[model samples]
Target: MLHIPTWKRIVIWGLVVLGLVFALPNAFYSRVETHNDAIQTIEMQGSTPELVADRAAWPDWAPATLVNLGLDLRGGAHLLAEVQVSDVYADRMDGMWPDVRDALRGARDRVGTVRRTDAEPGTLSVRISRPEGMEEALRLVRALAVPVATLTGAGASDLVVSGAGDTITVQLSEAEKVATDTRTMRQSVEIIRRRVDEVGTREPTIQRQGTDRILIQVPGIGSAAELKDLIGTTAQLTFNPVVGRTSDANTRPEPRQKVLPSLDEPGQFYIVESTPVVTGEELTDAQPAFDQNGRPAVNFRFNPSGARKFGDYTAENIGSPFAIVLDDEVISAPVIQSHIPGGSGIITGNFNIEESTNLAVLLRAGALPAEMTFLEERTIGPELGQDSIDAGRIACLVAFGAVLVFMGLSYGLFGMFANIALLLNVGLLFGLLSVIGATLTLPGIAGIVLTIGMAVDANVLIFERIREELKTAKGPARAIELGYERALSAIVDANITTFIVATILFTLGSGPVRGFSITLGLGILTSVFTAIFVTRIIIVMWFERRRPKTIEV
Candidate 1:
């Protein structure tokens, strides 16, 4: 008997209804998108009259999840940036200066008057007044070398210390350089992602492309230049002891000090100690606020270790000027009035509210490990994306119409049932995509079109099997039952193999390829359900109602 249990029938129909409900939002994509954005803004910032009106664009009880459009479909910025990993080497050497100087000072009698000397980038050179002290100095510096952390770099030291005559040169070892490069790339990617996400862009792709390169695609941003401005700013903030203030642009600083121009006052420069008392890496939180003068400023808090260092530095250096350096420039040099023990400080400069807010976002996101040079940049226009969307819609409609015509002409009433199931299959696919917040690209559209054709494969096999059964003089219900029973193995085997391929594509591919694979994989699951279960239930209900003694194929 061709029959479905009461519970099974209800479950099948219930899922179909749920899928349609979820898919309904995508039909009104712009309205649902605006509604979702308005709600998110209200949650993040606060409710406003305009925002409230926008939120009411869609029904409050209705589903608000819409399939996110990919960069290609929505139009946005694309960039290929090459990270300057070598830039970190100089900073690394600068950081190690304090340790090296302390080690040499322990044997001050042996290594008389040690001084840091200028050298090439990535290399640190130290000269001693007495040539005889070089051997003792080398031993002291070599002691600071630690084992590399990576497994492949086992037993290898992080620093390569070498000496000749009165000078000692130290640079990162080969293994350490490789490890630093990897860490720098990873940090760059994470920081970039944070910066982009801070702006609340939808589905931005930030991934490492090669050894030192990154690929960024942010949808809804104005241009590539705008995107670059957001992530390219190093935002390296440091607090250093000021050596002196000068008006000469070409002024020379003593060893271990740098001359940086003022951010507010033109032609004014401040010479500050190279080593900072605290860096932005220790920042725990940052927010936009107003200063005592009611000017826009950024407020920041440091971690425990930073707080301790800052407290001690301020306590000892009372009445001395402290330079707040941002990206190699001094933003302000204010005298230490008291021991600021809480580690909370304010940064005030010539800034508007927007600038203050942006600075706060950057500080909270943390600084990039290294600077990035844009190798390629492009801005995709929304008009072009709309054209692509129109073309894709046309292609899908054509394919769908052709498939429907062929099926209806070939399989008669059975084909009509399959067509209905196919429609449900597409709705279910979109529903799953929305639930997962999947991004839809142009290639993803092709996957849906392909799925429309493949959804009828099982129905075709079963209908042909029924035609064969009819030749054996079987009744309508008996032939239909045998057809489905015989076709089950074939349907499962075919779909299983295709689904595995889709999984592989998704695992190995990126960008558009990934979008395609996601749709294809989800479509396979939905098509199988609709073709096997939905169509079968429809045929069973029709058989029970008519009780046909004999039927044409």
Candidate 2:
């Protein structure tokens, strides 16, 4: 019996207390603001560069662990996505061959029947480019305003040749650089969240959880179709020429109306800039604030070219309203008061606190580099999370008490030593989880309970082995020594196999399952140490000091 010093016992108990202090705050992972009794944020208005958020309404502070938790545990939205890999190749070919159109145009004259599709020269639509003869067949197709149409074969010679892939280099370019931005997936998830938040939704969870998938879970949201619209659109941001008051008549009229919400309001139109004058990609920051007159507004800053173009447009259109359109909606039409130099300006509109916060989040996320298709979406409520916590607590209490009773009944006084070891094992596990800031879900709780059974199994195996050795005429001390030495191989073999499965589960499973695997892995490690070391120390101390007569049964 190796008695632990009083100081060692004190240190062990102190560590257990310290662990709880760190783990609880990390479990919640949210900071909500409630105005009066209702939820809200600071409502900012026009022109003011800075506005403080509502301190009284906001949560006291941020939590320690910001890890994403299971939707059922924390109440969030889940979205599954499918990215079209073929579209990636098509977009790449678009930039690589600007001269392909010239070759197609030349082919139309020679081929008797040639048609040009929107598909680039070497892509899925190259058959339409017949280089031998086709002026008669392809000439009338040009009259159609449609983007792409297939041509019929009306030629004696139809040559369809494919590009030699063996000669093609997988070279990257500036266009590819733009297409493959690191935040493209993050932006799409954000856009979907913004699209929902635009309608004033709250406490949404949006995450890029897979190689090419997004998970969004919005609490209290019953319908998610609107989210699909936001995620699906490319939301390409660009600078276009506003049809200034003087140039309105000169602008070419399209079939579409000016797209104003009210008939009485002045019409607004734009000529898409041949190349984007500046792109939203350069926007570094945005914030919601208040103006001198006190209306909701957002302040924004642009890169060099965007600032130059924005200043020029304001100067040219002084005293006339220039529409700030976003995602094709006329968001605001503030009259140009003066040239906005300094690369910064404010956008003013009739907005509430919800609208202001949402806009700020959207601008920060920016637009996705390409389109993403949502395959599935799910939402989990907070009520379910509470239910899970209650169930987990009940299961743990029942399993732990059952294990304690079984160990005490079977081994008598030796069971008391094992129980203490079990207690210490749990304390160490909790302390490690707290320090690491690991998330605990229902599955994770189950893993801990499973560990209790495994922990007792180690002690029970050793105790039964000692009983068998004593029956074979061995002394009590010799029996105890033989029991521990012989049981070591079996315990190691059993735990090592279980450890392998836990490792695989942690590596392959998603979210909650991974949490379960982590807890199980940690428990296996601590359980082996406590079952072998702590229990042995107690049993050895009892034998040495009291020289316990016959097994205390």
Candidate 3:
């Protein structure tokens, strides 16, 4: 076990030196981080003298990555939101109304004139003028049903069509409901992530909690309320043809149209078509710009399909007024002066620079499919986070000191060798964590402290084995070799068992528990390398130099 070749010794020392070099940058984390940020800014924009000086403060070739502090370590916001998935089901059925009407209208002679009636939220109820043609009406509606493409309900149809008396009801099938819920949840997560990312904040945790809830954590945000405001908006935008303008708030709109209050003018309402010409889902880009009147406005461009539809609509309806609606309210009503075929348009609203900029961000991120209700919200203060970090640092230092003193006193020079390995073990841990940019939480600090003590256990076992070998009539060299060889099995068994436990904790735990498991697992790996491989190298080099015949254990 002590017969390490020259090549192996060189490789082992090389790794230790590399770990120390990587870990050294963390000792001056603030300066290194500032230098890294400066370099990134220079790369993105033209570099100034001040930025060049900041970049020169730290070497670019050195590892600049630092451990990411978690929300507990850095002040941030936490919010738990439950998505209203059933809302999508209702919206889905409502959207299908036009298709259903057109299909049933094709067979008007047999099914008779059909009129829609109010039913449950997710059910579409229609009354046929003729009761004798109910069977034919069922066949027509059934023909519209398409198979659901999901793992659980792959072969089943997406819609359920049932009829009783002259009334026919249409609703999503069981399989379709599951598929819709899954899709809604996925879209909600993606939209939320995009919206948060658009704010240009640092790393944010956006994870699905269960079937209906999402857990969001954003470090360095001011408060939960601020984060909620950023993502709470549905930002639904639409353009509809204006049927008429009205002064009365209670004025009734015509069929297939609705009354919405103007955002700029108070108490002014416009009756516009409920069905939109185009939705915000087609918008590809939006930026804040000045309008023809030099007013703050939002400029938007559409995707290919949206551009085609919008172009056709504007070309066909010249000189007619259309309303730019946002979140159910008409933001502006502008008359179409000429054919707009470019697919780009400007929205003039009563908006300041900030409002225009925010609106542009929302448009660029797209709209959420459904609304969300916040179940829990919290804001951690920076002062408290700093206190926790200070306490953790002190605890780690104290634990490290105690372990080093105990190991040095118990095993003499060999214990000192173990202590050197233990120190390097910590450096290696930090090096690995920095390389991966792992988030460090309060519990993670505790895991590191625990590892300090555990790291010395292997050294103690080996030292005791050497003492026993000394008493059994053996030379110093032979005793050292036998000591390491005999202790190898026990060291591997103990570390492997502890490693398995750490793996289990990581797999089953969440949040802070997961942070603890990460450090514990990584500490085990680094400690084993330093204790077994590193300490052996140091002892062998020392023994070879001294050539001691009578060694004192």
Candidate 4:
């Protein structure tokens, strides 16, 4: 007779029943649901299956958990970035009050008569008549205040400043460049991820490359072009005075715009370039609504400092028009009627429902810390993702079949019981996955097949030990108990190593790798329970019901 203690028998039975609870949630969901399945178009107002999952109205729930698909599985935009550490350092140096005050002193010394200058943070400005000795004075100032020592000090004048606006450019060394690049890329990744998340791009992957570069992948994104513009656009707005008559800039053939770029009210326009006087980092919130005439508009709120700068701009250029240029296209050019305060203002542009809503999202997300240049863009349609999924399932089926047939051939009647246990093991794993809401991937399916083999091996080891005991001519019950006690240590030791390896993979791997690790980890846990305890109880029950004259192999 085969023997199992009453408490031990209950424990094994309890595990089998527990698997049913894990699988029950499947009744509410489908394995392959279409877009129509997602929405109940004709759903009645009452409480029904159709009215469930109506959390769309909630912004926080816009990108809900249940539906996070991969990049290739869905279509979306991709982005690559190379952060400008030199630019960041230059901005910091130019903004220093000591540097700005010193540059002002040098300008007075060289020109003998100081003209107007705009000395903002991170930049020193000296607007003389483009003076005779202006070049030398700037050289002297750069050497004193903005030294090439802090940057890559190789330049024509030993100062790496651009003379485009009488600015010196300094180059950085290999070491300084590498460190700065890495820091900027990491910080930029965090900020960009937050912005994209707010915009509701599903499961966007933002990661850092070797040093200065970054990669972003988003799936199921409908507005790839708009997202591209938002990602790449330097949302830098500046206000500067019109040097000559306001109308002269507009007349210039090269810069073909109704209004020329100006700080003054009389001639103001927005310019799109890699640079910006004020970045969107200063903005806080944004909302969408219709203007007085029912035109689509966005209400954007800026930080206190940004609001003050904007207010001063409005007061100085009351009658002139300022262009709202995004990616160099003039969205609107509104004249300032009065100063804007309270840290918030509105923009009226000819926009539709979606565009206006997205603009608000972009503005609220603030500006990208630096421009990100795209290196690669790969799009995978849903048709291909579905095909891959189908193939993966077929592979799993084949693997399981092989494991089952081999186990039954080797173990005879005992192998048949092992096959049943393996089936239960797989059902329990998926049932737990579906209930816990883990997204299934191709690698995850592979983890299941791997679980099948391990489950069979556990049973075979125990049954083989029982056969060895029976050959000693002892009673059937004594052999069965000794078999379980002896094989338990070996089975646990093998599975423990695998569990630790899965844990390490989960910790270090990225994206899809993590999904496979998670499935393998969960599969390992479920396999141990069903294999050791459940199989023991079933075999014991068989012998208790009817003891065999000759034990099956």
Candidate 5:
């Protein structure tokens, strides 16, 4: 009646051994963590003697994975940034100016001379000198509108063009604005992730908080300001043909050009073409270097299409000054002395080495789709995290010791069996955690403590059931079998209900709450296995070896 098949025996013991093996690395936490970091560094930056030595200290066959600590455990900076999604609308309108002007100019005979008027940043206002041709002017502008390819904005045009008397006003349609905002937010998240990853930090959390906000938590960072400096820069670089240089702010630029102030010379301005020949979007690589004058500079290389376009522009426009504009300010307007074929150039300014290096980093990471305004920022200290870890460790030990004593005093030998199973259950929990690389927080530690108390409850139920069966004059084997059989339904029902609750917590919660749910869920699984299978195996083997005719529960 108490017999276990050879296969089941092997499976149960095999799982126990695997759990202990996987859990062993946590005992040597610092050493194993160093080894893991060394391996990753070697893989990323090639192997050095120090890295090789550290990696060699840990065997390859052993589990190298460790639980990733959260921002609270590791010292880090956290930031909540809201992307200015409306910024893209202004840019879209600015870019469409040339197209609108060209289309209106084609119908000059009917619409008279077209002049752009003052309007909001996201709107284009043009005055058609002849009011009779307003319908044709509106038609020409609407021809440029494209369909918004988004779920909510399907089959909608990108722009809404309206006319009032002789004036035409154009702005982004509501559907198109929604589509653009969604795209901008998604691209912002991806670029932020790349920027943080390029800095070589371990396990940074870059997630979207809502429609327009992003939550960034990077552990081991010095301060939130440092992270903001790394990611906040737009770094929008463009090369526009210089229309002319002047000191007058009132000078009207050409229809397809604009005037921008020089960064190096405050009063001087450069009138440049609004359309760029090439932008930073084409850049494939950027690195910090020194110019011929030994000044800190950033060197950039373009991709194939960008290289070809740049080469053609330089070849045809040799001796013409081209302005390098960054963030709407003129950095330099250097004259092209020769045809540059390779699509590589250097940007030099009054930059120190650090500024040049940071510029290079931003270029390599690509530009954000929109500007970000920081809403919240904070730095978590390592000392506070250490205190939390210390408190959690003490609580765990206290709960564990208390449960062991309580179980031992209540069920005697069977209690000792349950204690061994409980120890293995905890080991299995850690083993699963390490394998999945889950983050352990203070709440997670509390979940494990709760699990310890729950783990013993099963053994108490079984022992009491066995005692009840013994009172009915049943043999030790039959009483144990009946006890396990009777208790199986209760154990399954209770644990299943608790597991569902844990799942709901994980789905609905964030951060520390989710961490607690993870440990609670894992604990439920391990405790159930240890209680129903592991403890039974130990009891069956003991009873068979002792050949007891009657036993005290």
Candidate 6:
């Protein structure tokens, strides 16, 4: 009557074996990590003798999935940066200048000669020669305004156009500014994430904090300064028509033009158009390669729209030079030798292999929306993390030992079976975590210690019920069956309520809090399985072998 079917027993044992196998990689963390990294490198860059040796550190057939260590458990960099969202407003006004000029020129008969005037940042102003044409100029400029593309800003114009006397001023509306800030924050977060992920760091947290701030935590990085250098490079690339080359660093350029120093030559500057013919935003792919002269360079390709524009520009101006600018510096200025039809080009400079590779990585990750000012930075050392790990380990060991002794002393042989199930419960928890690639933090270890204490609750209930049943003069097999059946409701009720709380925590929390929820949620499932099925199966098997007339609780 108190027996499990042979097929059911086999299925349960099969799952236990599979879970433990998946969890085996965590026992040899460094070796499996090396093997995984080596395998990834071989796939990306091909294998060398050293890489081949590292790849063989772990067997090919074994599961290589590992539980990632969180930033608190590993040395890393942490930064809180405030995005300069106001910087984009000036660029937005600059972009709208051409449209404003063209609109005003369409009615030149009445507006007379139109000229741009110096205005404050985030605002554009233009002066007309004839004062009587102010109303016409304002009307023409206002026609360029479009509805803002946001839910709350629906039907509101993106630009506010106004005129006084002979001058007309244009600026972004308040609704549009709010929308722009949201977009800027989203783009900054995504770009930072891509830049960090390009270096293959594990479990980096790049999240938006408030209105214009971001929090970044990267594990296994050298320091905060190194991380800042990686993500801070704007990598803004543009191809502009070169106006003239100059040796004077203080040379002033005409309107809609800028002077930038050359990257390869010292004290040499080039004046180029302010507006670019093509930008890095249109780039589809970038890779490191060698030029025809065997020098390190980067090869980049543009999308279809960019390809068409580039081809037309090259075809029309076959002899003119175009400056390739990166972060406001002229990286290269090559004259068009012939009609270049394809959208692909090579960027050659005084670069070695490493610089070329880094350039390619940045280009592929795309440019940041705007600059960021680091407000706070901290570098966590590995020594602190090791101490935390040691403390957590000692706490877990103590909890484990105390639980095993208490269960063994209370329920005698049945209590020993409960201890065995508790061990299996922990193994299954780690196995699940490994399978899901969950990151472990200090709080997550606390959750595991809590799980160890809670894991024996079901066994206690079942044993007490068995004692009660034996006192009623029930047979041994009937008492065991009734004990498990009576305890099932209480076990499910208690674990289900706790699991709901864990789910809520996971849904609403971030960082270490989320890590704790992950372990707690998974521990509940594993504990339930071991308590209800595993320990019961072991007890039933023992009873079947012994066929004892009266069993002690």
Best by TM-score: 6
| Position 274, candidate 4: lDDT | 24
Model 1 whole-model lDDT (C-alpha atoms): 0.91
Q: So what's the TM-score on candidate 5? A: 0.81
Better model by TM-score: candidate 4 vs candidate 6: 6
**Candidate 3, after superposition: displacement of residue 115 in Å?**
5.2
172-201: candidate 6 lDDT, tens digit per residue:
999999999999999999989999987778
- Which residue pairs show collisions in model 3? none
Find the 10 residues in a row with the least total lDDT in model 2: 144-153
**lDDT of each candidate versus the true structure:** 0.91, 0.59, 0.89, 0.62, 0.89, 0.92
For model 2, the local distance difference test gives 0.59
Please give, for residues 1-553, the per-residue lDDT of candidate 1 as tens digits: 7889999999999999999999999999999888988987776456899999999999999998888888878899999999999999998998898899999988999988888999999999998888888888999999999999999899999999999989899999999999999999999999999999887789899999879999999988999999989988889999999999999989988888889999999999999998999999999999988899999999999999999999999999999999999999898889999999999999999988778888998999999988889999999999888888898899888988888898899998888988899889989999999999999999999898888878889889988998988777457788888999999899999999999999999999988898999999999999999988999999888888888888765
Deviating ranges (above 4 Å) for candidate 1: 41-48, 247-250, 264-268, 289-296, 337-343, 349-351, 470-474
Q: Global lDDT for candidate 3? A: 0.89
For every candidate, C-alpha RMSD to the true structure in Å = 2.5, 10.1, 4.3, 7.5, 4.8, 2.2
Model 2 clashing-pair count: 26
Q: Please, what are the lDDT tens digits per residue for candidate 5 over residues 5-115?
A: 999999999999998898899888878877977877775446889998898878888887677667877778999999999999987887788799999999999999998
Off by over 4 Å in 3: 1-7, 30-61, 108-120, 125-134, 151-156, 163-168, 197-211, 239-251, 260-270, 281-324, 329-365, 469-478, 543-550
* The best candidate in terms of lDDT: 6
Better of 1 and 2 by lDDT: 1
Candidate 4 overall Cα lDDT vs. reference? Answer: 0.62
> What stretches of model 4 exceed 4 Å from their correct place?
1-180, 191-205, 216-278, 289-296, 303-325, 329-342, 381-384, 412-417, 431-445, 468-482, 506-516, 533-553
Model 2 RMSD vs true structure: 10.1
Better of 2 and 4 by lDDT: 4
lDDT of 4 by residue, 1-553 (tens): 4556788777777766666555543433332222223343322122445334542332232222242445554456666767765576555443443453456566665544433344433344444444665676556555643223334443323223334453333333344444455656766787777767765455687888876777877766654565566576554433232223333444442221224443324344443222332345677877888898887788777788878877777777778665554544455566768776666767676677677776776676655555666666655566776776678768878888998889889888778878888878877786677556665666776776677767777787788888887788567777887888888998899889999999999999977887788789888888887778777777878878888666866
Worst 10 residues of 4 by lDDT: 56-65
* Candidate 6 root-mean-square deviation in Å: 2.2
